[model samples]
Target: MNQKQLVVRHRLRELMVAHDIPSVQELSRRTGIYYATLLNFYHNKFNTFNNRTIATLCEFFDCRIDELIYLDKKELCGA
Candidate 1:
């Protein structure tokens, strides 16, 4: 069987460093996204995310969704 996993690249940290964002709180303030949500993204804990959030982040960062998340495929071998 084959399975696919959605892997988040989490480029916000790098973008923050490049843009001197300082902290997630600052990012939240700049993007109007909740600090807790940004914190979860920073920590790679993305159990709950939606199009609105993604759109907001993309608009704030001037980036596309592909820059934020991607999928990875894995194959399982059965005996």
Candidate 2:
């Protein structure tokens, strides 16, 4: 049998480009999210999501959760 895993992905970069956002620092300043935190997410180096941060980003971007974060299903091999 094959196993599957759900990988989490974010569209911050894409959204930024589509919205004409120049840099992550500007986003953080406008959204009131910490620069470093947004930087981490911008680079996809985050291990977990912060609800408040997500909500703030959604509100700032006028977007929904599905538009921000999504899951990717992957199959894994067994030992």
Candidate 3:
């Protein structure tokens, strides 16, 4: 199997919905991920997450690597 190419978008809102995280504001407090940045991330206004940020999200959600990231066709074009 081949590894999928990932887009540089963030999906914090989707994660919140799947995990029942109440609100971005609350999640921000809980994750210490910065309210405005997290909001921008969720809204697709921000692109890309830093290694440390990804690590923080994973650590907070107790999720494995695959659970945190995904690939879409647009991301595969250059790969």
RMSD of each: 2.9, 1.6, 5.0
lDDT of 3 by residue, 1-79 (tens): 3446556544566677888999989888998888887777667775656787778888888886567666554523343
**Candidates in descending TM-score order:** 2, 1, 3
Candidate 1 per-residue lDDT over residues 1-79, each given as its tens digit: 5555545466888778877999999999998889988898889887767778889988877787877665555445551
Instruction: Say which candidate scores most in lDDT.
Output: 2
Candidate 2's TM-score: 0.87
Candidate order by decreasing lDDT: 2, 1, 3
Model 1 bad stretches (over 4 Å): 1-6, 72-79
Off by over 4 Å in 2: 77-79
Counted clashes in each candidate structure: 0, 0, 0
lDDT of 3 at 44: 72
Alpha-carbon error at 30 in model 3, in Å? 0.2
